[model samples]
Target: MSSLHTLLVIASLVIGGMAGMLYQKRRNEAENIKLNKTAEDIMSRARKEADEIVKEGKLESKDLVYKGKQELDREVKEKKKELSQQEKRLIQKEEAIDNKMSSIEKKEEQVARKNQEAEDKLKSVDKVREEAENLRNNMINEIEKIATMTREEAKQLLVSELLEDAKIEAARELREIEEQTKSEADKKARSIIATAVQRCAPEYVGEISVSVVNLPNDEMKGRIIGREGRNIRTFESVTGVDIIVDDTPEAVILSSYDPYRREIAKMTLERLITDGRIHPARIEELQDKCKQELDKHVLEVGEQTLFDLGVHGVHKEITKLIGRLKYRTSYGQNVLGHSIEVARICGTMAAELGLNEKIAKRAGLLHDIGKAIDYESEGSHTEIGLEVAKKYKEDWRVLNAIASHHGEEEFKCVESVLVQSADAISASRPGARREVLESYLKRLENLEEIANSFDGVSKCYAIQAGREVRIVVEPDKVNDERLVTLSKDISKKIEEELTYPGQIRVTVIREARSVGYAK
Candidate 1:
């Protein structure tokens, strides 16, 4: 305790003196902490005031820091709210876009399936058509017994053989198909003729009335009879006509099958009555003069008409004979008018079928040329016409047409067939020529009345010049099977009750065509 304590006391005194000096230095350093001059100028205050301001600034800093921190917190909260709203809106937009995309994808898939189905159906249809074509070719090849024969040859021979049989069978099987099919086929064929007729309506729709003369005074007619009455006999013999003095107002009765002869006789009688000269010499002179004039006029008219029709290479004598047809009537119909109408109809129909329209027209025009010569020839009109056409240097097709019009020979070309069809159509068309007016009306009325007499029949149209009768039945009253029965019944009734030309077809129409809209 004596030495250790003495050394500790000396060390403590020395350490205490150093501590005091350090304390003094710290105090002086503390005093040196004045306001920075730069701060004083920036803050615009004295040094002491700057110091106070610094202290106040430190307090204000604390408050400002706290306020700033609160504002930052509020901003972060608002930003989060905005971000949440934006996220919600983005999610809705994404969902809407996805729905639209899904809908488009579904539509695309459906379209793809439908397209594939359509393509498959088209491929199947093509395959079926090809197979049917091949089968037809093979079958045709087998029929001719000549393995090397082409399909065309085999088909031609088969057609030639089956034509007659098919015609009979088709007539028999008219009731074997649905009435709709029959009606459609009839309509197609009728449409061709009707359209041709209607489109090219002939300009001449007029008819002529025959003239019969009556004497002005019956007493004068007896005086005109010479002694022994040889004058009347000679007059009749020279004129080739019958002269009758009837109780007429101011005319003499003139009757003759030949209008030209009747006209000549009428003119001669008028000249005798005017000049008071009734003698055989005068009669002979008048007859010769009238004959010459008539001949000349007939020739001129014939030549003019032939030129107008553009008929080529007609013999002068043939043209004169053709002109003579103007005076003649076939059952009260104008043969020339019939021929022209036939030509027009044939041309139009042939054009529609992509055939030679000019040839068809030419054939049709010449079809009745034989009728002009038939009066002098021995054969039928068809044969005469064929020979005449050939004599006139007509085409072979035209010659065939003329020959085949009355079924005198087989048609060689399609144009011949068309001409025949046109001729038949023209002859059969309403108002084309005169028939027994009473019989025609009676037949038409009978056709309708007969159809109406059948059960389940609502209406009937006599078509194809009474060749066919289309009967309509109430859909509710008659079903498809009964429609066929009704048609058969009506056809039987027509045969039993009505008199008609050619064969009469009884058609019953039943239709079912569906219409729909795509979604």
Candidate 2:
């Protein structure tokens, strides 16, 4: 019974354990089924949410596509509108171009027709001219036969008679015209000249190249001529001037051909006389100082001249040359003063004549620039003035005025003529220039002699202050042609033999005598 009971217990235990394991496996299967069901439900819920999200995204994509389509349609409409406008503009331009082309074609046709008509008219004119020429030749032949003289001889005889008659008639007419014009012209010219002269009257003074310095005493001369004249020699050599220590009470003369040098020497000597330092070193120092001062003064004078003339834009070099005219003289008249007078006269005349006043004044002011450099340069003042004008690149009119003022060149304009006239007036004005009385008398005598030397001149008189020579020719010896020839010869001889400022007028007078005593 104990063995059996033990066996039963073992069997019961095996069966109980098998039963427990079976129960545990069944519970595990039940839990696995619950977990799988939960998993399925969760997957179904996730799938529904995903489906809703995909639907929403599809709707949004459809809306976006619709908006994009609307925008593309609007852009297409605008493009079409722009293309239509461009086409319309192109059509209008094409139509206008075509119209212009048609108008040009019509004009060309009209011109062609007119050209053809002109050609026809020219042809008719040529035909008429041929016929007229034939008629003229026939008439000439008939006239030659009737007259019993050759055409050339007849022509010569007719021409001679016509010339004689024409000459007398022309002379009468010319005299009448001259008389008529001369009065008006003379009055106008006199008014202009008088007004110009009255307006611009410069002071008349003779400019000399010598500078006179007053000394403290005659003893100063001794000191100046120190130690065998060493001081005087040194001063002369340094200053390029002659220091004359003559017996002229209390004055010494500083002489130099160059006015600038003389001025420098004068200033140096004056400083030396004042400072009581008369030595070579002090002279050189003072000379240098005086030169600087003189340079400043020259520029100032140049500026003042331009200012007075109301002229601007002159080259500095030209202005400097103008200033140097202050020291230059022509026939004892100050060149600078004469230039200023000429400028004023030119300005006044230009105003009256309706020309550029500034340019006229500028030309007049610079007309004598060559004289300023004539000592250094080798040419007449006119030629030198031309060179200066060219160097400074002045206007062509100004250059012409300068070159022609002295008759060295041809007048290019009326302004040049005016300049010449003004120059003559200024130079020939009384008291404006001076010459030795002996020279003046010699010139007049020479003029009379020149006129007398000409053939057929019975008597000659130099009148108008030697500016004119009147000749009384014998009518028997001199015909009208011969009188003109004689006058020309006399004028030529005077030009070749005499040198006078301005020009001399040669007048030949011939009077025929038909005095039969009518008792």
Candidate 3:
């Protein structure tokens, strides 16, 4: 029974095994089918994607080609437009060039035609000139033949006659011109002088040869005299001035020809009196100190004078000389005052005459600079002044003015003449200078004597303060022509023989009268 049971179990086991095997086989087959389906779907999707990709690529390529073709056409069209514009511009430029060439050709043609006309005109003129010249020659020849003389001889005769006629006409014209010019010149000169004089108003300097120092009391005089008169002697020796203690109340007189020395002496004495210290050493000390102070003062004065006159750049020595002029006198007029007056007058006249006022003023101021040293020097003021000016390398015009102011040299410039004129104006003004009675009378007498010494003078008189001389000439001896000659001779003689300020006028009168039968 166990065997049979075992057999049955075995059989059941085999059936179950078979069943399991079949189930397993069926599962395998289903899995294989699912895998095949999944593979097929994946392959189908890949093919569809590849085909879409190919279609998009072809469309993109076509669009790209179409865009490229459009761009090329646009570029070609722009190129054509640019080429057309260039062509148009070339045409316009060609037309303008052609117009300019035609205009230039026209101008050249006109120029050629005008040149031909000018050549023809020149030829005609040459022909006319030749004909005129030939006619003139023929006329000259005929005249020479008719006159029974050669050409040169007839020319000489005609020239001589013409010369005589010209002389008379020229003389008449010259006389008229002289009269008119003299009148105008006199009027103009008077106007200018009057204007200048009106413009300048300077104070007149009083002439004082000695300096008077006032004292506090007469007792001071004895103190100045000192013991044994040694102090006065020392003062005089050191200062080169004379001290006069006289009855003049409370004043002592200081006298010296050298005003500069007198001024120093005055300063020293006044200082000594003020300080109440009087001695030989003290006097000399004060004198030297005063001299130094005066020298410094002199330079300051020169600088001030230059500033006042608008003049500059004088040498230091020359400036001192200029300051020294303050103490000097000319014809009893203060030299410095006179120089200042002359400078002002010169400046005024120079302004009116349109000259350099500074140069004129400078020349005027320094005109009498030599008078400062004339006492110490050997020559005349003019000569010494010239030497000093040249030494200082003054302007040529200034030198000329200085040299010619007194007629020692000829005037080289208008400024020089103005300087002389101003100097004369300053010196000749009323009360500007002092003259002795003897000299004044002698000058007038000499002037009359000079006029009388002339041959044709019947009577003569020096009038107008000896500025003018009138002469009555013998009618038979001096004709109108001779009157001119005699007047010039008298003037020349006066100029040579006289030393006078300003100018002298010589007038000659020639009159012829017939005896009247009316009685």
Q: lDDT: which candidate is best?
A: 3
For model 3, give the RMSD to the true fold: 12.7
Error of 1 at 325 (Å): 1.5
- Clash count for candidate 2 is 0
For model 2, how does the per-residue alpha-carbon lDDT over 1-519 read when each residue is reduced to its tens digit?
999999999999999999999999999999999999999999999999999999999999999999999999999999999999999999999999999999999999999999999999999999999999999999999998998998999889999999999999999999999998999899988888888889987778777768899998999998888888888999999889998878799999999887767888898899999999887788789889988898888888999999989999999988888888898888778889888888999999989878899999998898898888898888788899889999989989899999888677898887788787777778776667776678888999999988888778899998756778999999988998887788889989999999987678899999997878878
Off by over 4 Å in 3: 1-147, 215-223, 245-250, 436-446, 449-519
**Model 1 residue 321 lDDT?**
61
Ten residues in sequence with the least summed lDDT for candidate 1 = 203-212
| Cα-based lDDT at residue 23, candidate 2 | 100
In candidate 3, residue 167 scores what lDDT? 100
State the displacement of the C-alpha of residue 12, model 1, in Å, after optimal TM-score superposition. Answer: 99
Q: Against the true structure, what is each candidate's TM-score?
A: 0.49, 0.64, 0.65
As for candidate 1, its clashing pairs are 214-251, 214-252, 215-251, 215-252, 216-250, 216-251, 370-385
Which stretch of 10 consecutive residues in model 3 shows the poorest summed lDDT? 428-437
Q: Model 1 over residues 1-519: C-alpha lDDT tens digits? A: 889999999999889999999999988776665545556576665766879989999999999999999999999999999999999999999999999999999999999999999999999999999999999878876864657777687788889889989888887687566686988878877888878888766643443433554444555576457667766777788988777755665666677666556667777777666666667777778778877877787788778776765665667776776666666555556777777778888888887778988788778877777666565579877777777767778778888887777666787888988887887687766666666668887798899998887666777898877767898887777888898678878888778877654457678886555799999
